[model samples]
Target: MAAIYMRMLGYTVTLTMHGFNMFLMNNLLQGPVMEDPNIRTFSAMYKRFFTVWTMFLQIFVASLGLTSDYLTLKYSNKKEPYWLGVMRSMKNRLFAAILWPTVFLVSTFFWSLYHYDRSLIYPLFADKILSSTANHILHTAVVPLVVWELVFQPRSVPKSHAVNVAMLTVYMSTYFFVMYYTYLEKGVWMYSIFGIAYDTNICFPLIISFIGVMLYIYYHMQWFLTQIVWQPQAKIKM
Candidate 1:
């Protein structure tokens, strides 16, 4: 069965270790490879890709998710309205637990698709810089964890769509702000698609609109999958 600690602890440890290994490999063993003369290895190391940011955030939020789930597991089994029970069984707080880790899982899917042809989006240098194990950890392993939550950890849809939308807006806006700031500071886009969009006028607006529509669709889609399809498996049946 999919348990929160099992799901999140695995993600947290695996990702942290992977990142540590990379840090060691890059800094100590061989040193950072400066692919672009314009971009410093230090800036490029921490502030390179959406995938890296997602990995960091997913690990962070999923740790919180684990704590939320632990509280619920410990307290929700009984009738007392413990604080952890609220985090676990409540509609809105539970949604926050589900949504944040999902922000990265969703990005993982897009990253795989975008990297199909490195020349088109990711570029060839990425392959040399990041090992296949690192790539798979970031791109492939995340999908099953997301699916696990959908199948085993379902929760009823939150009462207010506004709250869900606001949560998503704040999270995604933070990512965009980071992306924009990184670009301004380093003269590079985290992903090639963004750089291409920024260069064109019409495409930029269309891209923004497209992302908004996708966010709406994804939120509802997750709700439908959990609330309708997998509701029976939920620990606190709604």
Candidate 2:
């Protein structure tokens, strides 16, 4: 249910951005009237307004996700049995498994930052490379671990492959929408995969790399769910 709400929120924001972009692009292509200073002033105002508005919206959404994550973790940790007991245990194990890798990634990232040139680092940092990496870790690693434990790890119930694919599609779409707004508003390209400068050839490879990372996280979550959640539940039932 939380996932569904998050997906809707993201989709609505994406559509709003697309609408605004279309309006701007159409007016720009209509050709300027040089004699009309008012028109130019209006255009400038519109651009500034939208830029600030979009930035606020993006920040709001990101903060909401972070808040939601905190709430979810807190609620889950209460052990109120919203889901099956086995599922809860599975989630716990999955969360534990993710901690080590998350620590490793953050440690490596910060260590590399120490050796980076200050001038070079500013652009990269401003482009949200660090924040994006953290966001990706949360989405690809942390969220999945939580979902596996909270949602998927109980009842000996097998879900169809299609269901899994649909859920993933929704998740990725939500993620991409948030990222698009983050870049659009700030004019900062975080990952090379989404960089406008690159041709499809280069961009595609980066996208593949991104996908590979997500898949790795997904499978790892699945393994943890199965081993820690299902196996132990099976043993108890035996």
Candidate 3:
């Protein structure tokens, strides 16, 4: 019983921390960060970026997990509620399928481009609006946080790979469409690479295709990791 309670405490603390960081980041972006003239100028475009979208999603999931944890603890002596289990299962699926992959991909690609040439992915002028701390929390800290969730939490893997794949497909496809739509409306590409090669070269499609493939790779990678961490027969369904 003590061990179980301690585990619950750990999960709650982690979720609270994650949720709080995201809330803080969102607050800064919506308030002080947006106050800057440069940020205000491209606010709509910036909001449409993949990082921001993922950040929002992560925040919501963390909040949901925390809530479910609280309810499960409150009813510790009773039969676990079905809805609570469903909430957790939903959270697990989202984490394994969408959140983990997107966060890893964003952090990896952002830092790679940022190091090679900051101007290409994250230009210097942009630094004034997004401080290094907030920047790292968005692009760097999230990687470990998601990994921590996978390792520490006991979660059932969703049985339907097709459903997971479909969810990811819709998510990436929507963002893909939004990328071109943003260019048409704002006359600016979300990533500079698109602006450079989208019209003349095959690089744009190739990059998008590569990202699509990587998403699936990351998805399966999580399943593999989960299988190693949790019981094979009971936890992992597919």
Best by TM-score: 3
- Candidate 1 residues lying further than 4 Å off, grouped into runs, are 1-45, 70-81, 86-117, 232-238
Error of model 3, residue 204, in angstroms: 0.8
TM-score each candidate: 0.72, 0.34, 0.84
Model 3 spans with C-alpha error above 4 angstroms: 1-38, 156-159, 233-238
- Comparing candidate 1 with candidate 3, which one achieves the higher TM-score? 3
Superposed Cα RMSD, model 3: 3.2
Cα lDDT tens digits, model 1, 62-96, are 55656766655666557656665555444334344
Q: Which number leads on lDDT?
A: 3
**lDDT score, residue 70, model 2?**
46
Alpha-carbon deviation at 127 in model 3, angstroms: 0.7
Error of 3 at 209 (Å): 0.7
TM-score of 1: 0.72
Each model's lDDT comes to 0.59, 0.41, 0.74
Per-residue lDDT of candidate 3, residues 87-151 (tens digit): 87787677766888999889988999899988778866577666787788779977877776776
Assess candidate 3 and give its lDDT.
0.74
Query: Given candidate 2, what's the lDDT at residue 44?
Result: 40
